[model samples]
Target: MLDFFTIFSKGGIVLWYFQGTSQIFTQSVNSLIKSVILQERTGSNQFTHEALTLKYKLDNEFELIYVVAYQKILQLSYVDKFLDAIQLEFRNKYKDDLQNSALSSNFDFRQDFDRILFEVEHAAKKQIQKGKVMKSFEESEKSKKSVKSMIENKKEEPPKKSGKGKENKPVKKTPVKEQEVKKTSSVPMATSNTSNGELDEETIRKNRERLFGPAKKKKSAADVSKSPKSPDNNKKRVKVGTKWVLGGTSEDAKELDYTDGTADNLDVNGVGVSLKDEELDYVGRMKGELRDVETESESEEEEEEETVTQKTSSKKSSGGMFSMFKNLVGSKMLTEEDVAPVLDKFREHLVSKNVAADIALKLCESVSAKLEGKVLGTFSSINSTVKTALTESLVQILSPRRRVDILRDAMDSKQKKQPYCITFCGVNGVGKSTNLAKICFWLIENGFRVLIAACDTFRAGAVEQLRTHTRKLNALHPAERHGGQQMVQLYEKGYGKDAAGIAMEAINFARDCHIDIVLVDTAGRMQDNEPLMRALAKLIKVNQPDLVLFVGEALVGNEAVDQLTKFNQALADHSNMTNPRLIDGIILTKFDTIDDKVGAAISMTYTTGQPIVFVGTGQTYTDLRNLNAKAVVHALLK
Candidate 1:
């Protein structure tokens, strides 16, 4: 039995829904929309959330999605057929409403739904019964006559003659030897007769000459390989030598210049400050390109304009189902052959943009599966339709499951007198600390006090780096402005301390100090480092930050998937929880460096099913930006 059925528009408008149970399915439906539909993962037909399993069908032309949810334990066999039948019936009944997306909430299809469901279930049951039913007596018979009549009519073939081997055995021929070869094989053998069937004197001489290489063409490899060079073949051996003697050069100090008073260069009286070991090992702040700062008004205007263009494009693309492919001359169904070429080219485009090869292949397969056997409109082309679908899919991939409002969340945490903790972790040199500072700066810019925990105790100058960033951020918003409370502060216990304990202590310190957010900077380690991974897992499990952001580089291609996958696996394994906590989100650093090769974004998102929480586009504190799914996809395809 179905627990829920719903039809919704791509723009988040629910047209009609049927609920068969009192249990609220809002969370399940929302999750389906967020984790599956919005993620452009329609490539998969089924989604499992807790106890329910959801199956969905997408109507690209109508920009609609039909979903059905049921208990996972039930082995419902008719969901697919039922979905297809309902889709047809609904489309036929409300073709105009769907085409226009009007009366979306005004449709009444309870009767149609119930009738279709019942018919589907009945057909399924009948199919099962038919398979189990036994055949009648006459139906199982090869002959329709009575047993006595069949016995009388039955006949056997007469035995064949036993003298076959004695008289009719095939006569084996002694092969005709060269006589047949001369007649069949066109390639003249070296010792075979000429066209006259005889080896003449002139032919023999010519054959002998041809057997070896021509004199002018140089000796044959066989001759050279078998014959060694003799002394007479070489000119007089001339030994040419210039600066070297047969014997080694004499060991002498004649050219030595150590006689000069080297003590004249040394001055013991000159005094200077002695640098400490820490000073000698200090690393200066990193530098890179920064994103151009955008004014609040300008950003809002751009967002509004982008939204308008997107809406217009979507409306134009699928306003009327038939209008889509109207330019294709006539309506025709798509086959594997029709879309294969386009999907191949699309896959190459994704790969060139640094998408993983396997991921690209699968994406092409998904597109092919969706387009196969589907009718194209008279107005469209295969390339264009495939591109449109691919674009939509990519946009869904980049779209986050939820609107991540860090500022709002931090504000809430501040109200509750608890620090909002965001921990940054990733492979080494991925700009984790830098991006942490960028986020910290953003938090401070919004008037919230931030504490950066230097939990990267393994690496030298890790604490100092955060300290420098804290100072810079505080300078940008000095303490004189917020009642003498510094906007940004760094909490550190120096190097060689337990990172996990440091993080826990930092959180409590922030809570006590009234800090709005604590950005914990964990040491970067390769995904394969078990000890470090265990340490990282312990930090997350112990402190349990509100958000665990994995920092990854955008420049990576196929390695992106492996790195993120391993990191997540390590966390889950090391955390040792029944439902272990994996990477909650991603911080994609060096976004600007990747150009159009934005496939790492897709790889990371696909691997973890998490969002790109922040993209570090530049070096400055203000260079961070939220991912724009459409813009990213556009760049990717381009």
Candidate 2:
């Protein structure tokens, strides 16, 4: 039996519902709305909540969602058909009210719902009853004879040897004529391709040779000792290019990564910030002119300018898929079949733009769901309609859910005599430290005192490099400007210390120094590195940074999902707190590298639902820019 059946609008109006049990389904139903309906994951057939199985169907035209819930232990085959039946019946009964956009929950649908539900369930029961066996007298004890008697009946006609005289001689193989009769009566071990199913002469010859073949003889030890052994036999063979050698020197140890402890004896790439002071800014550039991010395009006309794609151009454009729709003549409602081939090509086009395969597929599903039943206008083709829907969906995903005003938030934190801490984390070589420097510059340019937290003690020599950045940033804003105090300070506990403890101490130190903001720099670690990820989670959970930024490369494609998901999952799993601080936002770096494949922006945002706060377009701090969703979507579609 169903626990409940509900009809509700997307605007949270419950039209009508029936409850068969007293159990509260409010939590389960609300969760479905928030996590699925609101999240745009409606392409799924069913959703499970604890002990209940929830199946839903969407009526997009009326913005109605019909949900039915039942116990998972029950095999409710009639639920789907029942939902379809009831939806049609209810829509027909209230067709006049719904078409007029009546926004009331007093819908009279109970009688129609019950009648359809009963009919559907009865039909399902009849179909199930057909496959069931009937217990009768023929299936009783006499039909199941005793084991001994059943075997005794067959024993009387036991095997009769072909000839009594030949049986006494112990004949193994029969004559070819007798064997020819054996093919029909017995299963053949070797099969033949011939129509008669007889073994070919060559097959028969090979079978005879295999069955009566002579065994190979082993050489005796005494005979082997009589002859001298060859030198080639004594010298064991090994792979070429791998000549045996003595123990290697200490210099060879340098090849191994020394992530922890002192390595004075080995030549290594000294760790800290991956970037140098020289890369932060060239000596020729003036430090007085502070440059910030560009939220919009450089030219004012960038918004007004439209990019026209010509179908007849000598160089074929991304309008390749658009041209295919010309053959799909006539205007009508879109079906799954009509849009399947077009969406498949659209899916590939998204993947080509560096969108993750799974993300691209979900986008296509979303597009198909939105346009599945909508009719194309006389002037519009399937091509224009699909393109517009895709553009809107991409823009929606990229749009920030809430404005991230870091300047205002930092100022607010300063008012409370507390530092606004921002932690930077990502896999190795993604330039977390460099981007941190860029962010630090932005904060300082806005006239805020900053503390550099060197929590990346896992890297043996990484602390000093961040110190270099600290010195350069302070040099840009000397002590003379801020009451004889350096605008930026570096707090490092050297290598091989607990990053969590270091960040806690740094925040405390920032409080004491009256620092306006704290920038926590952690060691670069791969997403799959559990120990490091645990340490990262520990730092975030302990410090509870105002904003935790995940730095990623623009050049990354499918790896973007794994990197972000695992990083977020690691924070949630290992934090051990009720509410752990997952990544708050993303910092996409190397924006200058990827040309038109701006799909990374969509891929990262869609994976986490976190806005990309800062985009790193170059090596210098001034290269930072805010994410322009319009610009990114334009590039993606083009």
Clashes of each: 9, 3
Regions of candidate 2 where Cα sits further than 4 Å from its true position: 1-4, 10-14, 19-34, 47-54, 69-78, 121-331
TM-score of each: 0.60, 0.71
lDDT of each: 0.78, 0.79
Candidate 1 has which clashing residue pairs, if any? 325-377, 325-378, 325-379, 325-380, 326-378, 326-379, 327-378, 327-379, 328-378
Residue 1 lDDT in candidate 2: 89
In model 1, state the lDDT of residue 385: 88
Model 1 local distance difference test score: 0.78
- Residue-level lDDT of model 1, residues 215-314, one tens digit each, is 5767786777568663444467888888643344454443443555543442222112233444333212222222321223658758888998999679
Residue 341 alpha-carbon offset, candidate 2, angstroms = 1.4
Per-residue C-alpha lDDT of model 2 across residues 308-423, encoded as one tens digit per residue: 32423423454564764454545587887878888888889889999999999988887787777666776677776788988888887877777678898998999999999999
Under the 3 Å rule for N, CA and C atoms, how many clashes does model 1 have?
A: 9
